[model samples]
Target chain A: IAGITQAPTSQILAAGRRMTLRCTQDMRHNAMYWYRQDLGLGLRLIHYSNTAGTTGKGEVPDGYSVSRANTDDFPLTLASAVPSQTSVYFCASSDSLRGDTEAFFGQGTRLTVV
Target chain B: SQQGEEDPQALSIQEGENATMNCSYKTSINNLQWYRQNSGRGLVHLILIRSNEREKHSGRLRVTLDTSKKSSSLLITASRAADTASYFCATDNFRGGGADGLTFGKGTHLIIQP
Candidate 1:
């Protein structure tokens, strides 16, 4: 139970609206990531933070933003919601950026844009 | 862009049989990892293999990594209905100076008929 926790298991938003998905980890991990899972696209990384105060973009970063203000929280925000952005979002954390580290994931947030 | 690609997007097998999934990547990786996700749930870490490691085993799961060929495989022996899920292969690549994140491939959906 001492892993990642994501808020709002599911949400429905209107087009052009803004939404923020919350993620927190109790493991004190140094690396955190945000990914969106779609039917045929699999999991695509949106943003990542190697540590607190540092953030980097992943494969698909457009229209999404993330902030790693602290070690325990990494929040992903969508500036303007769109139908194409509707997908399940997951949060993951690892001990470090080392190659051998294993990542832990959250239950995921299912967001639907209408 | 997606760095890793999984083969045989979907597979069906009978219970107690074995299941195998393959993944290939486009770049040099520091490590490769396998994860499983049950329907409407979070992803669970199955195993991790470093660039220098050839194979690793954990319980009923086996993972093989061939860095030279930039491919990896996961084999599940004596599979059960519980083994039915989406399996994904992720790569931790050496991105040269910026913070690194895992690049995931489209997962393989395994169905174990009971």
Candidate 2:
């Protein structure tokens, strides 16, 4: 069973371009999250969804948007990519929003904006 | 800003040696989780310790939490070349008594020299 899968393993885009990072999970998890990782920094949460229709802003939400159309998918979109937005993005999911539950992660997408 | 801060950014040791990494946070959390990631890959859940719990063990990994000092540590015993990866500590900040997400540290790069 593929726990989670992310599209576009790596991509390079021009500044001001639009891009979307897709994440899908077959686990039917109730909660999903998006995070970005930069050198010398840990993963930073960009957005999260507690359930299919409810979403919340995370620690780092600027320049990013996410939607949970269904239980299996959560997509992160960058309306206009910028050089500063280039980073490794990761998608994670959990059975519930409970803090103690283990979170499963998908292989990250490396995005570069020039 | 990053809530958890890991000490000794990098560590290198012999295959059989023990490796320890510490993480400190600013506020109280519901739980602390440890994750491991190989270069350019998604993170894998290692272990989790709750606020009320002190220590937890999984195989060769031992994790300790001290709420008084607002810190946590992950100890890997009998490390192997396969164990060489970046270790991260994530805290679920439920400080306000509501739903919260994880905040990751800079992570500790553990290199197992064979």
Candidate 3:
């Protein structure tokens, strides 16, 4: 509704193909995050942006990259998708640093790599 | 090792029963948050308890935090079939003044039978 909006909903990508999962929030949040959820592995942080013009690596940021060119959008990209990267990806944002504010999340994007 | 880990991995209960889930984290956190995910849906923030606070409640959900133990528990009273979902606890922290993001647990899959 008035919160976060994700694109595609789901995607099927071939291994070695490039892919980008889009995330945008109308809340004008300063912090945005990307996480991958896998069975038994929990949710692992891939990338995050504390504010516009600044981005950083998370717990697991090897194959994923993120950019926050503006306050409203933070898109996650995979240079070359891999099967291991095939999982449910979630995008979230908070008005302040995650440590101090509650995060609002996008519906999620289910990705499968073949 | 995961920054946050949930216990019991899965739980089952009948309608009108109470459901409890626990989470443990490794580092000092600014806050701990509980979220719910229905199947493949995006996460919905249920509650957030700050490091300085011990407990918080919203509607039928009650959350308790023990900073000394680095643990937290969520209790849902008089739960219903609509509560069937994966419940996760996330710890918000800064690593070396960087890597600002929430580390989530594997989560507990709660099933409320009708």
Give the per-residue lDDT of model 3 (tens digit) for A1-114.
Answer: 669888879999999999999999998888889988888898888998988999988889999988999999999999999999999899998877334678889988999999
| Interface RMSD, in order shown | 1.5, 1.6, 1.8
Complex DockQ per candidate: 0.74, 0.71, 0.70
List the pairs of residues colliding in candidate 1: none
Reference-based TM-score of each model = 0.96, 0.96, 0.95
lDDT of 1 by residue, B1-114 (tens): 888899889999999999999999999988899999999999999898989999999999999998889999999999999999999999988565544678899999999999
Candidate 3 backbone collisions, by pair:
none
Number of the predicted model whose DockQ against the real structure is largest: 1
Q: After superposing candidate 1 on the true structure, give the runs of residues whose Cα lies further than 4 Å from its correct spot.
A: A97-99, B96-99
What is the C-alpha lDDT profile of model 1 across A11-113, one tens digit per residue?
9999999999999999998899999999999899999998999999888999999999999999999999999999999999988744468889999999999
Q: Of the pair 2 and 3, which is ahead by TM-score?
A: 2
Candidate 2 lDDT, B1-114, residue by residue in tens: 999999889999999999999999998788899999999899999998999999999999999999999999999999999999999999877554334468999999999999
Candidates ranked, most accurate by lDDT first: 1, 2, 3
